[model samples]
Target: MLEGDERTGAGPKGALFCPSELRIARGERPSMIGTLDLLGRPAILIDQNGFVAAVNDNASKLFDDDLSVKGRRLFAADAQSRLRLDRLITQVRFLSGKPGRSTLQTVVTRSQRRPIVIDAIVQDWESAGDPLLPDMGALLILTDLNEIPRVSQSSVMEIFGLTPAQARLASLLVEGKSLEEIAFYMNISSGTARNHLKAVFLRTGTRRQAELVSLLSRLL
Candidate 1:
């Protein structure tokens, strides 16, 4: 997490604007390397000056042949991958926070495993208006595509405050099932299934089935 520590080399001025639980105020969003810990994503944040700012728990154990952090800088083992990652970082540093305009993504090919994604996104520092962190700093999210993503029922239930039936439907939808199939599988009437799905959509803040699936797919 982004604690105000000297070892990160981001300097005192570039520490995480949204601090971790170890050090936080009442309203910090805890984004990316800190707040997004709930998504179970592997991510690290870098300051505008190119120093490591913070790392999430999932990202800490990812230091191996594929990727590693050195002297407060992230490094890829392959020369080509490293070059691409550097370019992504440079591009993401200048991104505008206009919803879809905030992130740059690329796939990092690995030798022993399937390709992984490198998603560099602009941090939402401007919202907090903390002078210590720069607005251009980026958070790098690492995802291994080969891993079989399972739907976590508990996570789904908690995220949307769903009932057991609604959570089951949401999980099935994320797993690529149609509402008809889910209804038959769950031994519920088609109308009841649709009602449950509509309620799920309302609670998850999504309007369409596609939107709901897209939102839950991140958990995968």
Candidate 2:
């Protein structure tokens, strides 16, 4: 959810393609696009016009035969949902400098198993403010809310040579838990949790919580 407006549902939507001239005209740079392509999650780059700029390999595989984003627009396969998605894009675009979020839901049918419902998160991309890089447009991230089960606590302990307490703290942090929440969950004091986190950071060579999360994401 965002400040002004936030909505959630099944899948994605938007314009078909970027005009040849508009491809590199505004938004993220080539390097940024390349970095997005490397992510394990499904990611799509869209211009301010809501045109699909680039799609990652995971997104291609996630949607499979049902959808294609290469040069086509990113949208729901169904018409009604497609219109909703268009409105979502408009809302997000209107927010501009401030990031807003909307989610759409869609079920991916399998050969024999039950359909898997996935949420596509559409949000404005915050710029890095690098003098050399131009601001890119918002990014669409596709997540399967059902996809659970992550790297185990023991796994993190083994990877980082952390103690049981440090491993527990690390696992919670990776799950986006704050230090206060971690302390409550572990029945420990905030100072204890902070000390454990400091140890975790030293062992993992990360200076911040975000960096630790990113490092763990790559490792996992």
Candidate 3:
């Protein structure tokens, strides 16, 4: 049995804890909103009823004028964006009631032709809490694929057999970095870093940094 505000129970399959109860336990009243902001990723926190309880600043910026987005339906901002988001929500709900992991990715092009890609992962949040809320929801992460630095497809296909991780590193290289910096962050030696770049250039057929950056930007 639960004791002294300690609510315990089984939740949806994917998430083991109740996000709403967790929020409440953390001092967020049932009516309040909460949010967390992460660098390079936009996130939102929703109430049990699927309302936009809290949204990070990054999410707010996507609305054009950067107005507050709380109290709105989680996907009410744009019709197209809403449709895409609604699918994600449905997936989250399904995964909550069932078992296993799920990930969804979709690209959205605004009316102005600006493109944005969102990658979302749904999982169970388990905790001892109220039975009214589902133990599963979603943790959505947004990335602007258009902003990704690019290299020639041939170069990307050739050098280091670029995995997604390697591609991200290559993109960072276009932003300009010393071998030492890359080595320190990537946990590789300066020699390895040079080798990586050498492979990248050879595959892309670009001899200069400027050329590589310019080429990759267009490709992305």
Best by lDDT: 1
> TM-score, each model?
0.55, 0.44, 0.45
Q: How many clashing residue pairs appear in each of the predictions shown?
A: 1, 13, 11
Lowest summed-lDDT stretch of 10 residues in model 3? 1-10
CA-lDDT, candidates in order? 0.70, 0.59, 0.52
| Residue 19 Cα positional deviation in candidate 3, in Å, after optimal superposition | 19
Q: TM-score of the candidate numbered 3?
A: 0.45
Q: Model 3: residues >4 Å from true position, as ranges?
A: 1-38, 47-49, 65-71, 76-78, 127-136, 146-220
lDDT tens digits by residue: candidate 2, 131-192:
33234345666665445425578888888899999988887887778899999999999999
- Which numbered prediction scores highest in TM-score against the true structure? 1
Instruction: Quote the positional error of residue 78 for candidate 3 in Å.
Output: 4.9
Rank candidates by lDDT, best first: 1, 2, 3
The collision pairs in model 1 are: 30-35
Per-model root-mean-square deviation over C-alphas:
8.6, 12.6, 12.7
